[model samples]
Target: MVGAWIWNRNKERVETCSAKAVVLATGGAAKVYQYTTNPDVSSGDGIAMAWRAGCRVANLEFNQFHPTALYHPQARNFLLTEALRGEGAHLKRPDGTRFMPDFDERGELAPRDIVARAIDHEMKRLGVDCMFLDISHKPEAFVRQHFPMIYEKLLGLGIDLTKDPVPVVPAAHYTCGGVMVDDNGRTDVDGLYAIGEVSYTGLHGANRMASNSLLECLVYGWSAAEDITRRLPLAQKVATLPAWDESQVEIPDELVEIPDELVVIQHNWHELRLLMWDYVGLCAPPAGWSAPCGALPCSNRSWMSITPASASRIICWNCAIWCRWRSLSYAARCCVRRAAVCIIPSTIRSRCLTAARRYSRPWLT
Candidate 1:
């Protein structure tokens, strides 16, 4: 909100897509984990922005954790896609022991929830930093062909997929829960829509079935398109939105604390990340899981005025607060965060999609 105007935003507006529509292509709640494949800018900002504007949000929990993200101390963020397992892969213990069997009968072939929870359980029991995924038993050609991206990145990081096991662990990766929407991407409110990872369509069930993430996007985006095109003909033209406000506020005019120190920002950011990973992870809500573990944000500006001399100090403080909040925002859905899974079987899929479809579209519009 503090930067919404600077970011070319404040309130949302209706839009004309190829015809008339919008899709909140915001990805998943993965960054809530310490290790993830999502770009750093992701923070469930789209979801919150939508909700604050009056869209009904849903199933804010039920995040999906990936079972095999690369876990070397130097390579924790790179995801080893399930496609690797689809081709041929094994989850091995730190000591070169194959342990997936003890967790699930299907082993690497089990659905993501089962596999990720298994990895989490193993990591805890073995007291190891992370487990490993081995594709080394496969021929070099096969390994290279199916996972060229993984192969190249690992090779650069000094781990060869054809010879050594890749360090792997479960990282929060997807939100099986999200603002509820329909197959048509309609939420409770009219003229709104949602799609992609942020919307929970029933197809994923309690745990996501493999390869359905992208498929859901395509399927429902099409549905949203049809619904929107049909509505455009009947939609009315509205008046222009108001210009931004500045008559009451002035730019800062000083520079006492603008050295641009990012250390505090980064440290708090990482701390918020690990908090989420440790608190809410795989196997769905394990006993006493809260919404997400994260830090509250505060800046010196909260204690000072936005003036020229104070601006620099405020900016630095603002940056630090933002760094903290953005990471925490990843796991925060709509409210202050209910801190519970809180989904009923009969309502799980429908309510989430309903919330997403009827309301989430306005964020990007």
Candidate 2:
């Protein structure tokens, strides 16, 4: 059941070690946000690939926002871990006044959902781009002892954690929703498996508690491995598959200078991030989902017209939007069903799921 697939960066071919049981451990889809603590590669590739392969995804709406990402133009989503807050770091306004206590009695130690929402609220209310995390009151020896990594990294970035108030903002951190998998890490697609942040295993309900993701990933990885081992003895072997089709794929007449097209792609990515950051991040209401959902098809059509090399990037962005919409609708539906009196009704979720499925059909098939 062990397998691997590596797509040639310069060519459109994917080299597979074996395809008997595909284990997709590609991590979360947090890069869809403008500001995310996720690694740059966390674009929901596993989730999108699963959906394309016809597996259902669930609970996409519950993206966990980390309350403190260092807000520096050069830092680029460097995370200031929750342990800083856990150790009595103060979340403060730009004017050096503390704010978290006003939002929650637990102050800096409140759950991520509440802290993220509070920071987001404060940022909006104060018309500020970023808030501050102050742990400067701690002894420098203690700071360096506890957070050697963050301290050194911040120091390298010219911000001393021992002296400076770290400029921070809430950023998309973890995806609580993903391709639905059973306890054995099995998806709807037979012989296909998902684990890590890519699979929704009912461990993280609405919000993911701290440090549980790594634990869940380790547990599920072992489970999937065990399940595959048991089935390996009876596994069906297949002949070598056909090569990739380039018939419908049009190679450009030349590597045409399409900086404008590339610029458009950049603009599209920027716009997508803006829509999510403004509407979907931290606090999502029904009204916020409208603009992005409405724009998806048009943006997708534009992206589809690009050259094949660029089309790959386009497809990634398109799939990100599609999955986000599905997650939002799914969560909205569950919320409405439970309460039965919310602005986002269950029907909205049903329609969103149906439409997203229909929309993705052509892309993967």
Give Cα-based local distance difference scores for all models.
0.60, 0.69
Model 1: which ten-residue window has the lowest total lDDT?
1-10
- After TM-score superposition, the amount by which residue 250's alpha carbon in candidate 1 deviates from its true location, in angstroms, is 11
For all predicted structures, in order, the TM-scores are 0.70, 0.78
Q: List the residue pairs that clash in candidate 2.
A: none
| Angstrom error at residue 114, model 1 | 3.1
Encode model 2's per-residue lDDT on 108-199: one tens digit a residue.
99977667777877787779999999999999999999999999899998999999999998898887888899988999988899999988
Q: Top TM-score: which candidate number?
A: 2
lDDT of 2: 0.69
Q: What is candidate 1's lDDT per residue for 1-365, written digit by digit as tens?
A: 11122222132221222313346667666665577767655566556545644666665555656778777676456678888888778888878888767755787898775677667767877788888888888999988887888788899999999999888887766667665787798765566577887666666754566678888888898889888888877776533434444344464445335455355556756765665565544433323244342242222343223321223234544432453254245345332254344444455333222332333322112
Q: Per-residue error at 203 for model 1, in Å? A: 4.0
Candidate 2 lDDT at 101 equals: 79
Best by lDDT: 2
